[model samples]
Target: MTGWLDVHAHYLTDRYTQACTAAGHHHPDGMPALPAWNPQDALAFMDAAGIAASVLSVSSPGVHFGDDSLGADRAARDLARHVNDFGADLVTSHRSRFGLAASLPLPDIQGALRELDHAYGDLRADAIALKTNYHGRYLSDPAFSPVLTALDAHAAVVTLHPTSPPGWQRTALDRPRPMIEFLFDTTRCVIDLALSGTLARYPRVRWIVPHAGAVLPTLAHRVAFVCDLTGTPADLPTALGNLHYDLAGTPLPVALETLLKLAPPNRLLYGSDYPFTPAPAALQLATALRQSPHLQDATLDLTPDSPGATLFPRLFAQQGRPEDRASPA
Candidate 1:
């Protein structure tokens, strides 16, 4: 694990920033202004952190930046394409060091489907990054079933990122949404999928749950009990075990222990939530992960050559493009 394969790094393009700024989405989900990001700065941080490769996706406040149905949907679609194209170019320039998890303009199934085709068929994205909720609609809603079906057809790897829940954004108790709301929203999305039978319906879609499964691990048994009482056939523990959890911002000992109880070592992946997390903080978490006593013999696959590679074969397989082994920055 000399060089990490970060599954949770973010890439912010200039076009994306402009879109957010113009839409007055500066404090998205109640977080402060968007963190600055540039290829050189990201590459420099990766070098210092010993990250050989990173799978990039857009951060919070995704593409849909406003409430206008017609206008915002169109803007979101365009922004999604721009972000994907920008990420694809980064992967092209640094084939071995960069991979893309294409963003989708959710709450708009047709537009998302179009982007999905372009991302996989045209740009060759490694995975799809989906927000927990879209305009107050959770991913498990029937409206998103079409997109889930399409993803299932491709057997796509989908990464779940948290966004402010519809009505809770303004009521975060004056604290940053990521501090508490993000974790709660992640749990909400997972529970919705489980209760609504979405997870059981689409088993092929490999889900990557960030922030160590984000409070879901702690509530797995309770959810299972409730499901049993309600006669829902969803198996909470098994559903969680089927998915991957990244050790990103929440890399504490308790978080690791709880997540491991649900997902095995093979299902664990490395993540550095860079830019959102400063370089020093990201490095601190990485060091803590390496030194964890529970993970002493866990075979944490942070590098490209690990069981984690099987999680996204289209991107990690050594068959297509020539590997770009050049120094980053």
Candidate 2:
């Protein structure tokens, strides 16, 4: 049980892959083609990387795949249901090794509400996964108030993943969106949520921001200054401090150092981002975390009583591995 608990892994069902293919979104957000995914392969990768368990979710370009209004919403609803059902099955089959962050069809409030109820009530999802922006609408927009209200009422855990920002394709940048724009979009969404008062209004919904808050460390002071100048009631620093972060891609000296400055050690969680991040890369990062001098004195907490444990207590409770359950605080 000497392994990490990965909070940011991804799972792609066969039907989900097909839906992406049909929508011409195989290389979603202009990244490389979707990687092959199977439960056995995922479990093997986790074992090889010393990952005790992984909380999975659908990744970028999510369920809303079409351009036509009616068609896209309908497709998103169906795909969300399919993906959730598949994820629920995985959780049931591999209770100790897997957890789920149910997907919702955003920008379609009614559809999202329906799926939320089904995911929380029927599937018993551990958390919810939301893109930084739904279509062209940011999460702070009033359009998502209903969804936010529901999640707030339940005191749910929400993980924010980056999507291709609007007009990203026209940027003329040679690199893929994930390389640069994904981080920017993630930053944008955080700022938007803070400025629009979503964080204040929905205090009970625990948030997990991936990729080490996606450049938030570098921009924290600047954002705080802007908030001051704008007369915004929200304090960017406080808002950011309250959220949990996942060490997904590369949690080395730079990323790790920056994150420590903004968040306490308990607020940090390990994330593999597997399938999207190949096993070798994920293993390398995990090894790096273990060897990092900065973490030498700190015990990596990944238990039900850890700082963000309330997000998915059931998943952590199923962690029968003694070492995992005994993770240092």
- Winning model by TM-score: 2
Candidate 2, after superposition: displacement of residue 230 in Å? Answer: 4.3
Model 1, 1-329: lDDT tens digits are: 23667889998978888888887878866777888998788888888887767889998889987664888889889999999998988887788777899999988788999999999999999999999998888988888889999999999988889988777747688788899999999999988887788988998899999999999988998989887888875578887887888889876868989888888877888889998888899988888887888676454444355645787664556434566655433
Candidate 1 residues lying further than 4 Å off, grouped into runs, are: 169-171, 231-233, 302-305, 318-329
How far residue 99's Cα lies from its native spot in candidate 2, in Å, is 0.2
The local distance difference test score of each candidate is 0.84, 0.84
* TM, every model: 0.92, 0.93
Tens digits of lDDT, candidate 2, 140-209:
8887999999999989999889988988867627568888898989999988888778898999998999
Residue-level lDDT for 91 in candidate 2: 83
Spell out the clash pairs found in candidate 2. Answer: none
Alpha-carbon RMSD, each predicted model = 2.8, 4.3
